[model samples]
Target: MFCYQCEQTDRTNGQPGCASAKGNCGKDATTADLQDLLVHALKGIGQYAALARGLGESDREADRFILFGLFTTLTNVNFDAARFTAFLREAATTRNRVKARCDELAQARGTTIQPLSDAAAWQPGASLPELLAQASTVGIQEGLKKLGEDVIGLRALVLYGLKGVAAYAHHARVLGYESEEVYAGVETTLDFLARHPTDVNALLSHALELGQLNLKVMELLDAANTGRFGIPQPTSVRMTPVAGKAILVSGHDLGDLHALLEATKGTGVQVYTHGEMLPAHGYPTLKAYEHLAGNYGGAWQEQHSDFAKFPGPILMTSNCIIEPLPLYRQRIFTTGPVGWPGVRHLADHDFTTLIQAAKALPGFRETASDESITVGFGHDAVLGVAGKVVDAVKAGKIRHFFLIGGCDGAAPGRNYYTEFAQQAPDDTVVMTLGCNKYRFNRHQFGDIEGIPRLLDLGQCNDSYSAIRIATALATAFGCGVNDLPLSLVISWFEQKAAAVLLTLLALGIRNIRLGPTLPAFLTPNALDILVKQFGIQPLGDARTDLAMALAPRAA
Candidate 1:
């Protein structure tokens, strides 16, 4: 098996991918191959489903399936091959379901409609062996002879970017947000790939278009989250756990967290947010839970150690779930797109089993001493204090603004983000989003004019807050966003971050400093295109980058 979708992908021996029995992320070959096949099958489904949409026939369930199915294939999300095998059958069934609807619609309208022969009519074997055999024809390497590595690289970029779109869209979707435009974009892009276009420029253009599409998805998600949970407010959350039967909810799904919270109410099971769920504490509807305790851990990468030590059951709601250790594997439960082979899987928003396990175990024996972290400074919160921020900037009390955002990973180079934030001058305000803020967010930076020097903007999905704040700041100064003192120092570890980057680029934002490392799928030529066209730069010395960003611009 070969896979290279995340920032931690192996590049050893002059190779660009993980081609071994196990991926660098601990994904076994069986799981990795099945993920690739799942991707292949999704595209096959898209080929037909996209045609149906074009004929004015669309299935909401099929569109939603595309979102969840592709999200499971993302790096560090799902490792259960059984899940992918099931997804393959689901993809085939959904494709046929949409295909039939489109056919009936076209016949009534007397419009001749044709579907792609390969994806529409393709069939994979029912058993594991047959599915494995079918996977051989549907991998990226299968087209290397005809498409070449360069074209394949661009295709992978588009596919990975699309995966990010799906993830954000799914998060919004679960909260009752739906967009026909976004759904059409997903299927339309997948169908484009099915047609096998090899032009380098076309592929790159298509990729940026997906980036444009991601912007829409992110906006919808921002609205869904705020509309339901209420705009995140500036709230300090306790890092120490309280004594009780506790349930730790991780991953990016607020919907799942809300469900678990409601189910565990009055059960003597206290809920604590972990990883990406930490910001949920700032939402009034979620934090209103009498037993909803504070956060219990840091980034998603630290789950193994964190989960082992926590004396309660854990529930993972979405991405970046590493392989669970045996110590807490039995107590760990996955729901809604997260799965591990041996870990118990919960579905249909059920948390009874998890709550039961939590009650059976000892929670925090004693409440730890109080220590807290501030989060939930989403756009509304920040913009609420906008007048003060603008005044401080005008008076030169605030030197510049640094927007450090994106997913956090375990890579050594990620420390650059820590040092970058640490070194920002006292006169400058540093705004951070996503889990990457964990690296240095705990560092104490006092406020200027009643505004904390370091502002936390919720999760990676809350990037809309950052964008809105930037646009508002630019408007206040009567200048373009790029003309402002803001600079984006982003650390990308997954496809969701990639989608955010494309959104920034498509908006004509320039000079984004991206790291811990470049995508393995971006060939030298593709990288050059981004560097030249978008003014994108690789992360250099954090100190040097900081100095460069703070330098004066010419009139």
Candidate 2:
């Protein structure tokens, strides 16, 4: 099996990807192969679903299944080969249902459907070995001999961007926010990929179009979250644990956390947020629970130590799950698209077993001293002070703005973000989102004219908030977003971050710095296209990059 979907992929012997028995993320060969086949199956569904939609017959189930199936194949989301095997069969069934509907629609209209691609008609194998054999033909390198590395890399870029869009759309979907436009965009993009187009310009166009689709999905998600939980407000959250029987919920799913909070309402179980769930505390409805305790850990990369030490059961609601160690394996549960072969998974928002496990475990023995940090500087909170912010800029009190954040990983070179945020001049305000903010959030940056220097804008799922805030600032100053005194320093580890990057490029935002490392899937030519088109640059020394961002030309 070969996979290079994430930043941490093995790069042995000048190779660009992991081709060994296990990847750097701990996904074994078998699971990686299964994920490949699952993607192939989803493309088959897309081929039929796209045609059906054109015939004026759309299957909502097929649309939702396509989004969810692609999400499961994202980096570190699902590693259970058996789960993916089942998903393959489900994909076939879902495709067949859509195919039949398409046929019926054509019959009613007396028009013949166009000839379909192989992906639309391919059959799944009956057993695991047969599936593995089939996977070999559809893997990432399948087009290398015919399409060359550059075209293949561009395809990977489009596919990975779609994976990010699917993940975000799925999160909003679970909260009952549905968009027909989003469904159509996803279906057509997958269908385009199924055709195996090799033109570099076409692939780049599709990538930017996917970016626009991602922007819409982000907006829908923002609405879903704010509609359900109300707009996030500035609130300080405890970083230390409180003494009680406790349950820790991680990932970016606020819906799951709300369910657990309601379930444990009167049970003496204290619920704590972890990873990206830290921003849930800013929501009025979620924070209203008296027993809803504060956050328990840092980023997802540190979960091994964090989960092991937390004296309670843990729940992962989405991506960035690693192989669980024995110490906390029994108490950790997974939901939604995340899976590990032996880990217990909670389905349909049921937390009975999870709550029971929390009750049996020893929670924090004594209350720790109050240690806290403030969150909830989303668009609403930030823009509410737009008048003051603009005034400060005119008065020459605020010099620049830095949007420094993205997914964090355990890989080397990530320390650049920490040092960069730490060394940022006091005159600049740093706005951050995603788990990467954990790098320097605890540091006291003070404030300028009563506005906090560091603003935490929810999870990676809340990137829309960052975009909204930036656009608002530009509007207030009577300039384009690129003219605003803001610089984006993003650290990406997986697909969702890829989608966010595409959104930025689609909006014509330029001169953004991205690292710890560039994605291995991008060939040099492909990377050059991004560089020339979007002015994307790799991160350099923290001091040098900061100085460059603050240069007079940049201003």
In angstroms, the error of model 2 at 431 is 0.3
Per-residue CA lDDT of candidate 1, range 162-208, in tens?
A: 99999999999999999999999999998988788899889989988
Clashing pairs in 1: none
lDDT of 2 by residue, 3-69 (tens): 8889988877475888899998999999999898888889889989889889887889998999899
RMSD of each: 1.2, 0.9
Worst 10 residues of 2 by lDDT: 140-149
Q: Quote the lDDT for 370 in model 2.
A: 98
Model 1 TM-score is 0.98
Per-model TM-score, in order, reads 0.98, 0.99
CA displacement after TM-score superposition, residue 463 of candidate 1 (Å): 0.8
